[model samples]
Target: MKPEPVILPCGDSALSVELGAVIDETLNGRVLALDALVTAESPPGVIETIPTYRSLFVVYDPVVADYATLAAWFLDRANRALTPPKPGRNWQFPVCYGAEHGIDLPFIASRTGLSEAEVVRRHAAGLYRVYMMGFLPGFTYLGGLDAAISVPRRDDPRLTSPTGTISIGGIQTGIQCLASPTGWHLIGRTPARTYDPNRDPVFFLEPGDTVRFIAVSPDEFTALERRAAAGERVAEAGNP
Candidate 1:
């Protein structure tokens, strides 16, 4: 049985419920379950909830609900055995892993002592889990990478990394939905817009969802980019 999560004060507007110290599926599942439950309940004065690797941050209005009251409520509900949340939408993104997109493929291959093709194959073979979306809008922190291709983050951070760069850092792998500086090793890129301000739903993937990478050619990537820019869904949804 899992121990009761510790509820701690987070500044003046938020409270953090720590599920565990390590990154594990069961711990993350509990965090998601609590999030889903509260979302469904729609408690008053709740601003928003942010779920991370092993904790959930509950933001609320202090005027409406005091810290003690809110913390007690969270503790009561968090202690109950919550059925794991139903699996969310599954997504498959077509990635171009050639020289142009996979900027650090050769470096990663050299460090791992694996051929470039083998590295790409191992990366594409991962069935990643969306642990949480943060660092940027629609940027998902994913888990479930194959151990063979795991690589450490770069010692020096890049000044700028292109949007849609698929990269790995330590034991975690994620899709960079926005252009930002990062230390992860970029292995590929996708045309799909994980965060589109014009779209009805700005975020393409949510926590509890699953994602897979489908290798595509450079020519195919160009076509997909055009289609995506024209407001089409570049990433296809897999059956739940």
Candidate 2:
């Protein structure tokens, strides 16, 4: 059996529930399960809940709730055998690898001792889990990368990477929501806008969603990008 989680006070209005010291699916699942339970129950004074790799940061209104009471409540829930949450939505994103889109393809292949084509093949083949949305708006930190192709992050971080950049760092891969500085190796580019403020749903993907990459040619990428810019939903949605 798993050991009970440690609950600690965060300032005067928040609580930090430390689930584990390492990053694992089971630990993350428990965090999500607790988040779901809290959401469903609508506990008083809960302002927001942020789930990370191994902990849940719960913000609350101090005026309406006390730290000790909330900590105890969260501690009891975290230690219980939580019912696993329902599977999240699955999304298929079109990715154009190599050439200008993935300038680091050759480098990644060299580092991993695999051909460029093989690198792309392995990357697109895995079904990645959206462990969390963080760092930037709609930026997805994904899990389930193929260990064979896993490589370290770039020694020199880029000043800015284009939106839709697909990259890998350490044992994980991720999707760039917008143009931003990144240290991960650039592998591909996707037309799917994970975050678009003008769109109905500002964030297309959420934590707990699954993602699959569909390889596409550069020509196809241009066409899909045009469609996406016109506010079209380019990524295909799969049933959970």
Candidate 3:
């Protein structure tokens, strides 16, 4: 299908809504607005919102709710959230592309027939919008990648890349929160750790937020690594 809003039963305790194929900042705003409206008129069981590239997965408490009742409420809010999503802030996250940080940078440059510098410049040229967070705890699927640098996934997925590995997958750019196997082309690594199971909220960076990438040097990544190890925090590009 082209892309449309879809709601599905999620194990009786939760409900999932696929918001459709949204790729632009404006569309992202509309999705978030519709999400907010639904939350505002939240039915008894509604719990949280999960926004993605083209969908929003609405999670709710199943103990007190059922799909039929909540789906009706959702459909109602979807009708209203059509106005637009209110603008949110843009975030910048620093990345040290290539080498140990980005294992696939060289391979990608070889395939794309461009200098590594040009690749990095294109990757960092524009701010990306947080399309959604899923697949992992704090991982974010964002838009705004320049198609010129877009490439296919790696044939072999790594056992895990360190948390904060910045990578390109198809037309999207993503930040890794925890080490996990992935097929995306690795371009850089970030100093930011957006997920912490021990932390009160556990996750930061919700959908509809904007993200920017600032390329950093290898030495800086080493310093940031040290700071991270010492329990001292590195001043990453984005705001909490």
Candidate 4:
């Protein structure tokens, strides 16, 4: 049975519509469907909407739309758009897994009882689903990790991980676009600029997108970075 959504106040002008308590794809689908519905409907005074793992935060102008009225409208639209999400675009990112780039690969392999090469192969082979984008702009929360390679987060978080770092923690994997502190084990690095403020869209990946990590050599990494810096689209899209 589908769970009843919980509408909660979020700050003065935003309300969060939680579709489910768990972080599952089905729940995320419902959340995203309602997000699409809200965007298409474009209710008066609505400013923007942010979709997370299983919730949608609707921001509106309080002067034009009251909280009680907005909350009721959100719930009404959510109930009407309960259809499953359609498959999103499939994107392939080139990743270079080496000592300099993936500093935590060896440790992750040792902890997971797998060889470093095997770990890389398994991680790259995954057809990961983008559950949501958070923590940072273009930082994707990816699902569909191979359980055999799954490992716990580091006891001590790294002070700063480089941009394009691909890592895994618990049962989830993710791609970080900015230098930030992290506990996830870094297994590879991509040259694709997932977040570029100067770009047309400003974000390369989105929630509901599918990702495939393609292993590349150090030489290829340098070439790709140059192209990406020159504003070339590093990631290619296909049918998911």
Per-candidate TM-score against the hidden true structure: 0.96, 0.95, 0.86, 0.96
Q: If ranked by lDDT, best first, what sequence of candidates would result?
A: 2, 4, 1, 3
Error of 1 at 206 (Å): 1.1
State the C-alpha lDDT per candidate.
0.88, 0.89, 0.75, 0.88
Q: Give the top-scoring candidate (lDDT).
A: 2
Residues 114-203, candidate 4: write the lDDT tens digits.
Answer: 999999999989999899888788788999999999999888998999988999998999999898999998888999988888888788
CA displacement after TM-score superposition, residue 122 of candidate 1 (Å): 1.0
Residue 124, model 4: Cα distance from true site in angstroms: 0.8
Question: Residue 205 in model 2: shift from native, Å?
Answer: 1.6
Off by over 4 Å in 4: none
Of 1 and 3, the candidate ahead on lDDT is 1
Q: Which candidate's TM-score is highest?
A: 1
Give the lDDT of residue 58 in candidate 3: 75
- What is candidate 1's lDDT per residue for 192-236, written digit by digit as tens? 999888876766688999898999999999999898888777999
Candidate 2 has its poorest 10 consecutive residues by lDDT at 79-88
Error of 2 at 11 (Å): 2.6
Give model 3's TM-score versus the native structure: 0.86
Clashing residue pairs in all predictions, respectively, total 0, 0, 5, 0
lDDT of 1: 0.88
- Return whichever of 1 and 2 wins on TM-score: 1
